[model samples]
Target chain A: MVPISYYLILSGILFACGVIGFLIKRNIITIFMSIELMLNGVNLSFVAFAAQWHHLSGQVFVFFVMVVAAAEASVGLAIIIAVFRTRETLNIDQVNLLKL
Target chain B: MLHLVLFLVFGAICVAGAVNLLAQNHPISSALSLVVVMASLAVEYLLLGAEFVAAVQVIVYAGAVMVLFVFVIMLLNAGAEERTQGSRVALVLGIPGVLAGGLLVAWVLVQRTNTPEVPLGALPGFPKTIGALLFHQFLLPFEVTSILVLIAIMGAVVLASRPEPKMKVPEKES
Candidate 1:
């Protein structure tokens, strides 16, 4: 048997990496990927907690989260494509202006 | 014993993939690393006995979402990252801060809560059980999310599609 804290710790580590990636990455798409990483980390936590409690709701919540993530990814990538169309660059630093 | 070893191994894979995602310069590389991370996460979910969630994680995340990310990267031909002053500062400051925060959280959780130990395949989250939960108790949210997905699809189409060309008006003769 593995301690529940172990899973939670791993999840925390993943979330921290995501935060670090979001902060340090220059590319907009890479930052977006970091958001996905954060979501994955949270999903892991949810499932871990569910297993610890022996409740199905947590797993159900993960399902809802996955649905939302799928929708968000589709819309977010489209927005990214649109931004690239206007800015002609993927670097977040260059996209400072609201109107170009 | 074997469960702990498997868990640790996959946990290491998850961390490695996430770190690789951070280390890689190009968006495509990061996207691939994210895929690796997600696949391993699916495995972890399976070990937790959330079988349905694991399958969805594999199919939706690894299959659909990553594909979308990779397709966009290819379409845009996104290049490697360039060093910027802001990024440099973030790299210097963010890593230690994040590491500290993670460690603190882990320590707190380990110390404060005597969370129970979970064996492999502890709580089998079968599809049938999940399906019943979705259709019965969570029915409203499920429908709402379907509508949300529809709206997202429409929004993506509108945002990504090219603008329509203006039509020429005929001049009136006196």
Candidate 2:
């Protein structure tokens, strides 16, 4: 039997992978892709819980989240493009002017 | 029997695509892998009997968001170059990554063995039920979240589309 916890654990693993990727990757696009991965991880958990509860609320929430993720992707990509134009480099290490 | 096969296939796809997303140096390749991962997740949602959720997964994530990723790649003129990889610190970090993944697998196995058999009763008219719940119970929060996302999107676009700085001529040496 495939328990819901199996899905939840998968979600957790995906989330951890996303976090590690976000922290370790130096590329701007890669970081945002990691963010997307993290979002997907959460969506999986939400759907799993929705199925477990026998309610559609969790799935509906996933719908909302997906919508938000879409908007975030568009705007985030636009900003990344803008940054690339200004800096001519996509390397996060090189963009450390934001850091003190 | 069929369900098991489908699950194995999609699960393998998700895992392999995720590994590719992270392991590949090219951002476009990673983005494509992410699409593969999202498609499989949508399949999982469909298998769970959440047709609406599955549709949202495909339409919003795989279709729209991934297109945005592709757009960024095109606009930036990104090429496959050597990714900054391998230092003492990165390798040190890899240890914890492996441990975390192993621990997660163990926990899942334990929990799966222990979970009781619970039959999920279906809610009639899934979409309508969800609609009622959102409108009646979570109406305020729902609208608020939408507004917040809208504001963030607008702000990002406005900031991103700002005028470029003009090139300045250097002053002549005395």
Candidate 1 structure quality by residue, lDDT tens digits, A4-23 = 88888888889988998899
Give lDDT: candidate 2, residue B94. 70
Ten residues in sequence with the least summed lDDT for candidate 1 chain B: B85-94
The TM-score obtained for chain B by all candidates, in the order given, is 0.90, 0.78
lDDT for model 2 comes to 0.76
lDDT of each: 0.90, 0.76
For candidate 1, what is the DockQ?
A: 0.80
The residue ranges of model 1 lying beyond 4 angstroms of the native Cα positions read B87-100
Stretches of candidate 2 off by over 4 Å are B85-105, B108-112, B116-125, B164-174
- Docking verdict class for candidate 1: high
Question: By DockQ, who's the top model here?
Answer: 1
Complex DockQ, candidate 2: 0.44
